[model samples]
Target: MKRIFTFGVLAVALASTVVLLAGCGGGGEEETAAIGAVKVPFWHAMGGPLGDALDELVLEFNATHPEIEVESISMGRYQALSQKIMAAVAAGEPPVLAQAYEAWTGELIENGSAEPLQGFFDGPDGLSEEDLADFVPGMLDNNTWDGVVYSFPFNKSVRALYLNKNLFEAEGLTRAPATWREYEDMARRLTKDTDGDGEIDQWGTAGQISAWMFENLLIQNGGQILTDDGKHAAFARSEGVEALEFMVRLLTKYGKVTSGYEYQNDFQAGKVGMIEGSTVSLSFMEGKYTFDMAVAPLPAGKQKGCFVAGTNVVIFAEAKQQEKEAAWKFIKWFTSPDVTARWAAKTGYVPVRMSAIESEAMAARLDEVEGLREVLAQLEFASYEPRSAAWYAGRKHLEEGAVEGALRQILTPKEALQGSAEAVEAEFLGVVPM
Candidate 1:
């Protein structure tokens, strides 16, 4: 991880070019009472409605707290934001707060780029017991490392099946499939060559195959990504093979899914029946689709499952005490039930705190949204992706192998997954289970 983050002089110079002064406050016990307003620069990857919602929150926070202001910076996408964060950290000028993926949290911690937030959690001005209890189970704990909390959940999301009800009705289906086999059967039935050209005009389902998707299927099939001890890769077992084979068979046998963004575009265009996608799609699909859309929990295999996504806010250790305090204030306010609920309602992200979901305001908002209830229900079965420094490297194997085995048919599912496991073992760890 350090090797990947070691920027050359040119990279450092480039990072310097991107630096901007964030805040106006100064710190010292003597000057504490007279401290000026602090401006916190927050780097985030969200765009569209999600970004708008974040900006709204920042505006509200700034209005209420005259002593602190938040400046939201858009970094395009998560990948671009992540790369910029690394470069910024290497340049010793990280934002006081930035959004981070779970795997990125591991990297940041390992590189000493992030500050452990346990002190804030346990401090006098920290979260109250009632506040602590408000968070959904595992949501807050997912950000903890070695018993220390290091991050706070921001725009979290889980997988949900987006169904076009008009298309389902055309197929004589009244509801979404409840099991894997049923889903596969429906996928085949819904696939169509409407123009008599023998070319598929409508697909039943489509989603990018990545480690997050693989992990969802693996867990749904009663398989784990790693052993209990977390020392070795364990997704090469029979259950894992079943998961891999099922996804590959969708393309090779049923020929339902299209490659790349075409599937999503098709779904938006009302040419696709259903899509396995994140709840965040709600924001993306708003006011644009031609069909009546509904969402349902993912189909079950050995068990119901899906992967949670979105990033968390992590403060930088390199920040001054005043800035850190100001950043913490923003983090706390952002995660508070009322504020978090407002954000979740405006965007499609899940509310981290249960109290937020149960709030009267949130209840009213959920009643207005078409598919949000189903998304919240999925939280019961969703799990966070693995947090590991090696995840960045190991993840590439699955992403590439998914294309090789599923779409291109260059290898069998087992061979592709096995090759991925072996590559992860050789490159990231020593010996994964075969």
Candidate 2:
């Protein structure tokens, strides 16, 4: 998956706020713990309900190993977490472990902050292979960099299509759009100016247009961000162009797509018939909507699908031997079947563990929401985006480039992706192979 694409390409490799990174630093009120133990501090970005889950997870782990006490701390969202990590590094008080995005790990690795888990992950009790044996193949790949694995999968997510079932019926659409072409057609049909005035009252779609979302569309159209080995920009080609172009068309051609937050507001108002969003967003929507709402697999593309996001658990190099061991143990328990199922059920973050997914409880959960089942089905065909240290910064370039193309309609897909690729390439300072 992502690791292969990155490793294959570069011989290399190579987050969000709380709640934004549901498995990140958001909670845990440590009333008190054992007096003498290998104390381990883990900083993450999970918050609210999800944070509660991670705190509970720590309590579960502590029940058995009293000697290894893990203190889970919430450090805020992606940007905030990034700042906290940097400040901690500066103060030389970095935590023992961190639940970070791939890019954050890259920055840590470059700064000599993250410890390479090569030996441990590859060793006899390596969680990479043993603990994750039940996890998705892609999660294992995503954890790898060049050849070294620096982290393990925690909770993960993807861009999913949420359809207001009532709207679907109102439009006489038999099924959700199978692809963006269908997506486009349905969007226009679903859009209406409910009032007599000539302004759009209902929109067919709306969603954040970050590089992650663009990756979804680009890969779907058969384009890749970089050469498999991470050698060059692959987006200047057809798939990338095709994907972004579709968005531009959605905005300018269809007038149905608008970039907005409060996706629920629009959808609940019956102003948005179809919307694209994260799988984790389902928990909030599940109980609120009166109209039937459904979660659909990210629409298919020529190349297939890629999960939009997920965070990783990376232990810092600064950790003492005991703390590192303790951190690894927490990672193992987190991905374990019973643990993974409970987290996924409560938070809606997909379980990376295969065993957890196969459990009877999970089967029953799937039966409850056939829509989410579609998201799970993608697991067989799912691939992670090319995981690279550069991807963190690279995504920003892709974001700006896509927004420019879509909103301003300034560049064709080719020009837009080429510009983005070039921007990414420029960051690497070295001679290029002829």
Candidate 3:
């Protein structure tokens, strides 16, 4: 949906030190397969159930394709993994395949640390036309920048509204909120002081004022994060203020929501009636909540909109021909319709392929899963994160703006946004706002 508001905008790893370094300094337009079993070092940030699911897929792939062996390594988290990868790249040693975000992809591209996948895709051993057509509409496109595809979607997830069905039923609300006003009203209704204490014991919702959440709100408020040329900030306008205003009001005015990561714990403990989080959280949340949990698309503001996040698989430019070939093979196998469908089912990520999502297998799997359908449905209205390297710095400024307005109350929403705009423009575009 097109945003309805005015001027608003939106928005690792480390591994084996020695072995990683030993596999460096080789690159070519075309990859050649090795005769023996080729070990592809793959780095990812997923842990717990998601990590287990990834390992299982690698095992399955290796079992079927004996010539290709994938060595999957959990790098703790995305930030840590990213730093380690960059260090490895600087040392002329990097993994054969690794999970990365668009921001990272932008950096890697600029540094010539990542390989463009366009050639591979158009090559003889590439995905067939039918296979390419099977991908979710925007999934593949999201990985492309400047007509070159540098990565493929992996472990992508969309933000979803998680509702406490029991609380909603108690309030006589049979369905999730559909708009901003409805969400506010429901939030107010759900908030309570159960023990008659002066302080409220339960909150209507918990909010995370991150760049991604801000971007979703900004777009929903009918604003764009950057100008058409992608050289200036555009989100500090009226629409931006309105978006931030809405977010701030939820906490400062209505007292419907609390800030911080504690919301997840609160939601599970039944102290918060609603929480918006990634689809991947479902794997960690399963059997953890005490109440009947339900998922729904984010409530629309002027229109329905969302932002999809998570990493994409990128082959380091330093990888050898054989390893590169093996990496692409693993990438292809991992993102295949059936494979991605099973991955989604097991790891709580949204499947990247339309064919997989609509397949009978996915249908059956969704039936067994509680909230998978709602998360998948969000793809229809989602947008990709900013693909420019500028976004890496811009995101921090955006987060600061949100914090100033929503948490600290140090600045009005408009002031916060304007300050953020100026900071981002100066830092990234090297322009000072007048």
Candidate 4:
């Protein structure tokens, strides 16, 4: 909420330092037949309060800039955005910027649909080498490919367990779980069908069981999900089987939670005692239910892990010079220490800049929640989703593959994991490393 951007209106004076300037120059570029206006389209996936906040940000951008115009269109989450983008590109109208996941970002750059923005570091008043150091360590590496940073991380979310404090207290549970075994022990105590209807009326833990979530949990349990190269699947190993067996035990043995209810809805409605989801869940959850809510870090395994989740800013390859410059200016403010501090405080996505997270504002906000301090502490051990085309093109198959083994009582945990791993391996048959 703090305006760290000073309105000096300094023109981009230096050119060569500007790394990705395919078409840049302040007043030196050729003028179009149109007068003093450039249209830059953006596609983003956000809804509810955070979406409203983004709309306000777009208005702020429009109000401040005279030469460039930004239009942020809503494209739903991963599934919806991918469909919309594919259709738009086929129709010859891709947006200037996109809000996509790390997997999608990798595919965009691989398909020549996106360009690296690292040159922004060298441009006139672009991100400095020191500025680069201010960023949260794992963010850029998550979105980068082949030695180049492809996406500019704007907002980030990480895995966290949103526990219903009232429920925990009612069940004599005083604290959140720190390790997988602890989580399992607590979940069993919390699961009970109060009505004796033979069906579960309450659950101790819930989440969408998929490959990525599998990777998140498995890695937490001392497992390696992807190969060293980041292109191949490595889930068929002992580590992978151990991870799947752990989750399968949750559904089959513990009976903590069912998969039918939407993750946030059930959590917010009070039927769910514990749910793991994006930190952005806080935005929708503001003032919803007045219960003692506290956040716990994603439970750790011997390996220690949580996936970095968020959107990044990207400039198109042939965008207008004025548009690119304007975008960079907004990005500078968006990613700055003070601005990101306020943003993380308002929206719940952890700031991707280390300085922003440490700023006094964030510290004060943490003092208020106090419980979230552990989540911030978990940043030191976060991991990235494996970047790949198969991940983008065929994540659902993996999801179904995982959910199948997890929900059914028929397959042993090892059997489920082996089948799921084989399925993912089949999908990665011909991926050439970049």
Best by TM-score: 3
Candidate 1 residue 170 Cα shift, in angstroms, is 1.8
Candidate lDDT values, in order: 0.79, 0.74, 0.80, 0.71
Provide the lowest-lDDT 10-residue window in model 2.
Answer: 11-20
Per-residue C-alpha lDDT of model 1 across residues 88-175, encoded as one tens digit per residue? 9999999999999877887888888789988987887699888888887788889998888999998898877889999999999998
- What is the TM-score ranking, best to worst? 3, 1, 2, 4
Q: Model 2 over residues 235-310: C-alpha lDDT tens digits?
A: 7777777777787776555444445557566676667877777777776666666777777887776756876477
Give one digit per residue, the lDDT tens place, for model 3 in 324-398: 988898888888889998898777799989888987768886886556686688888788766676766787888
Over the stretch 101-207, how does candidate 4's per-residue lDDT look in tens digits? 77766656766766577777677767877888878887777767777887888778877888999888999999998888888888887777879999877787766
Give the candidate order by descending lDDT: 3, 1, 2, 4
Q: Candidate 1, 381: how far from true, in Å? A: 2.8
Q: How many backbone clashes does candidate 3 have?
A: 7
Candidate 4 has a TM-score of 0.83
Q: How many clashes does the backbone of model 2 have?
A: 21
- Between 3 and 4, whose lDDT is larger? 3
- Candidate 3 has what TM-score? 0.87
Collision count for each candidate, in order: 0, 21, 7, 4
Q: Which segments of model 3 are wrong by more than 4 Å?
A: 1-36, 253-260, 369-371, 430-434
Which wins on TM-score, candidate 1 or candidate 4? 1
